[model samples]
Target chain A: MIYFKKVLKKIISPYRIAGSLFSSQYALMLEYRAEIVLWAISGVLPLIMLGLWTGAEARVLAGITKEDITRYFISAFIVRQFTAVWVMVSFEEDHIEGKLSPFILQPIYPFWRYFFSHVAEQFTRIPFVLVIMIFLFIGFPQTFFIPSNKELIAAIIAIFSAFCVRFILHWTFAMVNFWTERASAIERVLMIPYLFLSGLVAPIETFPESVRAFALLTPYPYLLSFPAKILSGANVNLLQGFLCLFLWGSLFMFISFYAWRNGLKQYSSMGA
Target chain B: MAIITVKDLRKNFRVSVKRPGLSGSLKNFFNRKTILVEAVKGVTFKVSQGEMVGFIGPNGAGKTTTLKMLCGLVHPSGGELLVAGHKPQSRNTSFLKDITLVMGQKQQLIWDLPPLDSFYVNAAVYGLNKQEASKRIDELAAMLELNDELVRPVRKLSLGQRMKAELLAALLHRPSILFLDEPTLGLDVNAQSKVREFLSKYNKRYGATILLTSHYMADITSLCSRVLLIHQGSLFHDGSLDELTLKLSPYRAVRIELKEPQPKGLFVNYGQLEEFNGCLVRLLIPRETLTDSITSILNNFPVKDLEVCDPPVEELIGNLFKNPNY
Candidate 1:
């Protein structure tokens, strides 16, 4: 019990930092509520793809019913809404403007600030996502079915894990800003793979066998398809999905940490 | 004990050269050329605890670079440096807790949030409990003369108020060592004086060591007794401000209101006659012979009034930077 208490204390210590960061960031997000609405509205790619798929009458491909397509895309929209990552652009700006210096001087790792800000922004998007969901259901009441309690819990955990994985992946690339000024160009390059392979456009199962195999080998499908599949009530290997999430999270965490250490050596506090 | 020490500190940056036109751009893009620019070159100095030292230099003379190195914002290309018994580059948590840095051009507070909110966030990161953070905020707020300004969003506050709030945030942890880069940059005279007074009081009250860089000489002349002068990426002089003035400009401006107008020849051999209009006269007298010259003028001429003061330090330092031979 003593050992457990000590471990719990260690865990709770950072909760203070997280709490303060989240509250302030949430307050800041509220100030940019207009921009948040636009960002939330912009993430309707999954719904747009659903419309494209159904309008073409290809929604029943490979035993996927029309209702299944609607639910899948709707779930995918929610996943994308919550799992969006843009730390790269934000990090690049701070790194270039020398606004990162104060964070670096503090005792905590600076990534926590970005992480909490992302989470806070996600919280701020909750209402808009709900409002969009209302419009989505109004358009197709057939897709308004509620998820089961088990699926709801599982999807939440998986979606959050996916967000973490995506954040770390982008943060790893964001470290390239230390060496080059145009790191955002890499984000544009990443968009090609993310849009096509992450099931944001179509269900992974609809892809050809070889293509599905190749996409699964990358971390992109798990970032979107796996959680949306759970919410869509489709069959999925929960064990394998979670194991891949853990492995990819670990790999990117290690790589990002290494990049961060190396990047600090090259940081000269530009524009300071 | 020396809280900060340096030996042959150096930093170099490699900047790429770009060409203008399309053909030149294509050629450059195909085969880019780069040159290493030494921002700081073998600069060496030591700052002991409780000492407020001024670091002065021209725009590109590496003052900010040296401060960046000391605060671990940039790793040194070469040198031995120790701050509070830790290598700054290592950036140990303990070392971080022992120091704070403030850049006037940049701010740490969230722009949309009130400064008090940012202060709480910083407090939490620094491990201060709520009560402790509040008490410290109150104390610092009083010191900075900030009242309700803390509640206003940072963007809404005037530059001076925002900077005061920034200082409150930076000093919340009360680190023993401070590295301030242009802390008084872009502030009006009143704001600058207020900041200087607060810094002076803080240094005396807490005995905290400060290494500050500024374009405003008043910040240095009013606060720091010792000044470190850097020029062309090197430490040119490190001593008392008065000593620097004596070394750089050995002349004082002597203004006199004579009872009657005098000829320029009457003061030709005395010194460099700066002005001789009507009954008023001005001369730049050498420091060594200033006493004798003043006596001769007082005795020989019907001097109605005489006032003596050293030449402006900024003019001297500015001229020195403009021409190294100065």
Candidate 2:
């Protein structure tokens, strides 16, 4: 009777299942604290861009001042840390090494397992990223603007949504491993556009009008630059940002689902 | 009733042909060539409830592929398949709950964490309540003698210990059907026997249907009475082990020990000489002529002791594989 009750409870509450997955993965991530810190430190590209853009002659690019560039790049760095997704490497390894077989046999879908694990990793990374943010604020007191309570809530929501957008998009890309062994190579190709257009290197607004238009058309701007603009207290149309995120997130979700269904058909699970 | 059924199941893989040299590689990259390799070619079989069946085959004989197809890991290119009354390729959650598949080469446990942590994760995935999950884990861990090892990281445990933990993780939900692919591979004799004993006990206790594939004959000889022989993606024979032995091996071995030293030539007339020690002789005699030859040897020779037995199970299987007609 107790067993039947437990099964009944499980059928009703999938959030509990996700919560358990999140907890286990969170514990596992905590075991790799040094790696998390190293990864947080590795998002230094925006900081480098900050240095380059704030020079005396480079202060006013596209009607933006040195202080504005500093805030934009710093916010970009923080956003990048939150939105990072490395599930592609994990998927490629699991597929190549035959580690995916066991996951396939489980009653739960593998997508939720991977999703919770990545989310746990991001959760583990938050404190380390917070420390970096504090140091950056202490170093550049004049450039940073303390967001209002309303702005803070909006920024949190936007950043989290951006993380979802990035996660779903990359997860869709990772599904390419189902058909080809060179998925990491393809990821490297995808990273080029993400680096330039997502505001990891420079704010998309600094680019010319034509380039900015193209960047907005792609999903890359919604991932990091749009959220970074929100965190920097820049003027952003909330409705437009929400619309872009919802559309792109749903599109990527569909692609991932379709790829996963087709990939299972083609998956050989080659190695033991 | 059949718990698992497969009919004309087929799986073919498309493999790209690579050229030898750099220029050939360039040309081949531009104009690719692919060939269809059939891993499982119209194989068919049925496993009834509460039956422990051994699936034996040579390397590349599609044993693993067949197991994968039945477990819903790999989709069959053609044919109908069912497990626990559901089409395996459908991969319904209810079907998944009723079945479990364990591969010796693969693991479901998280490598960096303790097996207990993985157990909890699996418990949640399978929807077992905390109390029931702990109860199941404790019971299985005790049966597999994994009390002290469950808390250690999986990588810290030896292969045998880890394999035991893997089994516990797989069986936590008490699946009614199990698909085991080389579950005893790469274990020492003691560990192998322990695993076999645990599996035997688990099967008896739960009345689960097991279809196990293994290269080791001991695993089959001990746990499975019914054996399925597969070769070249075909089921050649399916019956009791005794039946297979009788049909495939038509000869028995006879040994004679003399009170005094015996000449090697003395046993030549009785049967084909297999071994000739100083005071003992061994011969291979046809099953039909076994009693006559034994009587003649007893009456003619100064035999102090005599014994007759069938050939080793490994030797019989080897011979069976060698001859495709059988």
Candidate 3:
């Protein structure tokens, strides 16, 4: 009986399911390596800003050295590449192509498929990112710096957590596809605040105190700024960063499933 | 025992109305107009365990809507539905495990990966162990006559190979009930025959209940002894395939070959002239008038050969939507 139970548990385990899904999704992701390379290249904004900020004196962001700013921007670049979420675009494609129907008919929740798909895409992006970083360090060896072991581990955890928060947040918006056909247009509006406050353009510290405080209130700073700071070996409250990510991730997860239930009703009414 | 039961099932859609022309479009931009469409009126049916029944209907006749409701993809607007002793709209995991829905041309396989990769994913999702999944895959592959195609990318496969692969993916869990919509659409004659054969074999071996909808009459004629003919959002007939053709079509087709030649006009006075060439003429004479029409044509024209039979189900059903009353 114990042997049987273990078999049953293993069969139903999420790890086994995720392993199968990830392997299949990884194979599919590699087929689009050319597209992923271009996507990784497009995330060069932070590196470009690093160059611009390196020349500025202590005036740009108070209480920070030129070398620290360079490390911060490089950290931000890595964080942005790993935590980038595009569930909105993918969900819209599946919704339009009638692929969602097949997904809905299956035994598993459909978002799990999309989740593994996003994770697989991140894996595919790793090689391209390493190449870019190698070019950067070779061209300007002074920019190279090794983060402490603790800092590297914390940043990896933080970046992955931030990805969860961002994925659920964007996926919550993707539910708008069930109401209307096109929801990618809304992504453009989401970009305005995300670009401004996510520390992608510049560090949130450079902003006025009021603006920084406001940005912190939203989930934007936790997504990139907190993780980037940890990666750059800067001092940060690890507990607060993790807590904010957990709280925001939980909130969006609840709202997304609620929207999913209602979205199904609307799906049937859209002419089956 | 009835494994599937539905009563007075209905689906109503509230759709926006868009008028033609620039002026109407401009006016509608300010305030959109909308209307309620009753896509499926009251439809009721039942199928016993291991029974394979055909649900036949034209486009926009609520066939797919009804199937969607059975599989829990679409919630019913009203009425009751019970499949495998569970409410489908609840979408319980147990219920999902007991059923599967397959739609034509829409795929569940990852496009870039080989079908074998997706089969593994599906097996894991359905909680099948590697050994069990591999065993079932081998069995189904032999049954489907699938070989190396499982390892080829899905986009590279022929339409027939892709469809067979789709059936394999869907049936991986061995669901007790199957809901298939246009499963044989856009396939060659040989491919359709193979699918029909496989479905029959699967049903017999596992005693699975099937509710299939298809525009291909051959799919129904061969696989389903019983059929549910639907039209204009209502159930029209529930009987054998032959009975459906008989009820819908009140006319028998008569053909005659003249030794020489005859104008189409020469046959029209006797019955409705469906076809007329120089040597042969086809007519749809009402059953009541079939004898009189044939006699008159034979007595007048030098009939070299004569034939009479009920029209093909394809022809009868093809004209059904045009004459919804029939």
Candidate 4:
């Protein structure tokens, strides 16, 4: 009985439940091995931008070289892959199809399962990403910057924090389905601005001063550019960057929580 | 004591009305009309511990909505509901632990992976250890006769197998109360009977209170002694199946085999003639007048065989829905 009690306690604990979810999701990711490869390949947008920036050297702003652009875009590609959150599409599909009813009925909160699933995808995609990075470095050894130990540590922290912020923001938007059926359309509308402002197209520094200021004011910079900037050894205020990420992450986290609570109240589990 | 009690429970949903065609779609995009649907309107019922109750209703009569509310999947707009001594809408951990809801249309099983993986995930979510969860899975798998199917991907399994696996996933936690909505839906005759047998045995062995909703009359007839009938989002009747039949139908079907060819006109005075062939006849007569009608029919006609029985449960339920006041 004592052993059983211990097991029960362990299983019910949030941390253990999250760990189990992560493991199951990791296994699921393995089953989607081909899809993982396709997703990783999809991150080649930044690499293509790198080619564009390298060819248009005259268009490049002062103090930014072709090699610098290469490193910046490569770091952005890595950050983009790590921080990717497909929760909007998946959540919309699940909501539309009534697949979320079972999760809603579970004892554990449903968000943790979704969170673990995305995190597990990232964990599974790490090796493939590393392989790509290795190939890139082998081809253009001059472009890649090996960060200092301290910088590497800070970059890891920033990237992880960025992933959290992006996940929460995407989840918050996904909750729009609770009120309307056009959540995917809304997400598509939001994606255009996000693509420009999140440094997916170009680094924030490459933008005009006014646009750069506006981008920094939004949460998009902390989600993608800040982490990429950290990894590229760019001259950035580390303290300000971390603080901005934390503030935006907390804001989005609260919004997501609020959205979820309200969403549950409105959720009819219609099809099920 | 009643394990589940619902008093004046209600649910309302606001639905957006969309217009058809490009012009109407554009108009809807600007100003969409909305309507409120009263899915469950002031339904009330109670189920005591270890009692298997059937919540029978026609489509859109709020059976699924009520079940969803009891399981904390859908929130009630008004009224009170208590399941296992907890307010269902609160969805407390203890309350959730004590109950499981199974909807045949929705599944918890991971589609691409073996059911064992999903079972382990449910075990973790429900706070069951590896050893205990495995033991319970084994027991349930054995009961469900899902020996090899547990290891196969859920998508690969037949519908019956998938539903059985879904049941095992739900029951692994050993919930004290089970809310089954259309649990035997979309199954063949053999699979349906097998599912009903398993459910009856499970309830008996575990003493779990079960509230089931199914369109199949056989499901309710075989497993539930007491049933709540809902029509138009209201509880029309709550009693034993026999009581419901007697109350709504209040009639017996007297099937008779004639000794010779009988005129259909001759049997009309006995009762309402339901069937009349060359040498066979069936009549629906009021229960109170059953003896008189049978005696009269026998006295008038040369009867070879005769039997009196209540109308089929399906017909009785059908009549009840058509005219709920009965």
Pitting candidate 1 against candidate 4, the one with the higher DockQ is 1
Give the top-scoring candidate (TM-score). 1
What is the DockQ of the complex in model 3?
0.58
Please write out the lDDT profile of model 1 over residues A105-186, one tens digit for every residue.
9999999999999999999999999999999789878778899999999999999999999999999999999899669889
Candidate 4 lands at a TM-score of: 0.94
Best by lDDT: 1
For every model shown, what is its TM-score relative to the native structure?
Answer: 0.95, 0.94, 0.92, 0.94
Give the interface RMSD of candidate 3: 1.7
lDDT sort, best first: 1, 3, 4, 2
Tens digits of per-residue lDDT, candidate 4, B131-166, equal 999999999998999998988888999999999999
Clashing pairs in model 4, backbone N/Cα/C closer than 3 A: none
The most accurate candidate by DockQ is 1
**Tens-digit lDDT track of model 2 for A1-272:** 99998777857658768888999899899999999999999988899889888883534747788767887888888888888888788888888999988888888878788888888998999999889878887997876677778777887898899988877888898888988876978778889999988878877877778999999999898888888888888899989998999999999999899999998999887896
Among the candidates, what TM-score does chain A have in each? 0.95, 0.92, 0.94, 0.92
Q: List ranges where model 3 is wrong by over 4 Å.
A: A2-12, A57-61, A269-272, B21-25, B254-306, B324-326
Query: Scoring each candidate complex against the real one, what DockQ results?
Result: 0.86, 0.75, 0.58, 0.74
Superior candidate under TM-score, 1 versus 3: 1
Model 1 lDDT vs. the true structure? 0.92
Error of 3 at B77 (Å): 0.7
Residue pairs clashing in model 3 are none
